[model samples]
Target: MALEHAILVSLLEQPGSGYELARRFERSIGRFWTATHQQIYRVLKRMEADGWVVGRDVGQDGRPDKRSYEVSAAGRETLTEWLREPVQPEAVRHDLAVKIRGAAFDDAAGRARLVDEVRRYRAGHEETLARYLAGERRDFPAGGDLDTGQRLQHVVLRGGIAYERMLLDWLDDVLETLLKGLP
Candidate 1:
């Protein structure tokens, strides 16, 4: 999906200024889709110009006035139309997989470097999994009922959690092979 769609969904969840939207993306939406603040600001401008979103300046104390944006009727229509379209499968682009394959031709020192890189990558995935688990606990707390939107969001977060777990498991296999047959 395009960043525009992600922004629309975010604004639909809660109207907010660009800064606030960026913060939300960093905290939650960034788990699936990522965008820099500058990119968000630029898109907000275009979306406003396209009449997909409306922005209003809000007064602030000790700070410049901020323009808060909310999805316009056209934006909702666009999102609805986009949602009905078929989703194509995404292509995998895994650099670590390439590195692991390339290690087959490397010297002992080079293979060791590959192992170190894999360990570093595994560490990052472990941290992400921890964060996902923490977020699930903080957000869901109980297995109680959730609204449709919340349920869907929770499912998506669960997918991320499962993906991280799978990656970690696969990395362990890779690590074992790498260490066992070290050059």
Candidate 2:
């Protein structure tokens, strides 16, 4: 998906200034698609020019006015069209998988180094899993009256949680393999 699409979805969720939108991307949307602050601002400009988004100046006390953007009717149409398109399978490019395969060509010492790398990688995944679980608890609490959008968002978050859990399990297997036959 293009950055415009991501921006459209974000704006639909809630209208916000560029800075606010960038922060949302860093916090929640970053889990799926990442965008730098500058990139977001640039896209917002293009989207506004395309008449897909409307921006208005929001004044603040003791601060500069910020341009808040919201989806225009054209933007909703564009998003709907895009949403109806067939989704192609995403290409996977895993550096760690490549490195693990490359280990077969390396010396025992090199393999030993890779083992430590795997351990460190495992630690990072563990932390990510913990964070996902915490977010699930906080954002998607057990017995709440959720509207359709909230329910959909919770499902997506659940998918992220599941993905992280799977990654942690695979990383554990990688660690075990890396440790085997090591002197």
How many clashes (backbone N, Cα, C below 3 Å) per candidate? 0, 0
The TM-score leader among the candidates is 1
lDDT of 1 by residue, 112-183 (tens): 888899999999999999999999998887877899999999999999999999999999999999998774
Candidate 1 clash pair list = none
The residue-by-residue lDDT of candidate 2 on 1-183, one tens digit each, is 478998999999999999998999887888788899999999899999999999999899999999999999999999999999898687687899999999989988999999889889888878877887898888778997899999988888888888888888898888788778585
> What's the lDDT for residue 92 in model 2?
81
CA displacement after TM-score superposition, residue 88 of candidate 2 (Å): 2.4
**Model 2 regions more than 4 Å off:** 62-64
- Candidates' lDDT values, in order? 0.93, 0.89
Q: In candidate 2, which residue pairs get closer than 3 Å at backbone N, Cα or C atoms, i.e. clash? A: none
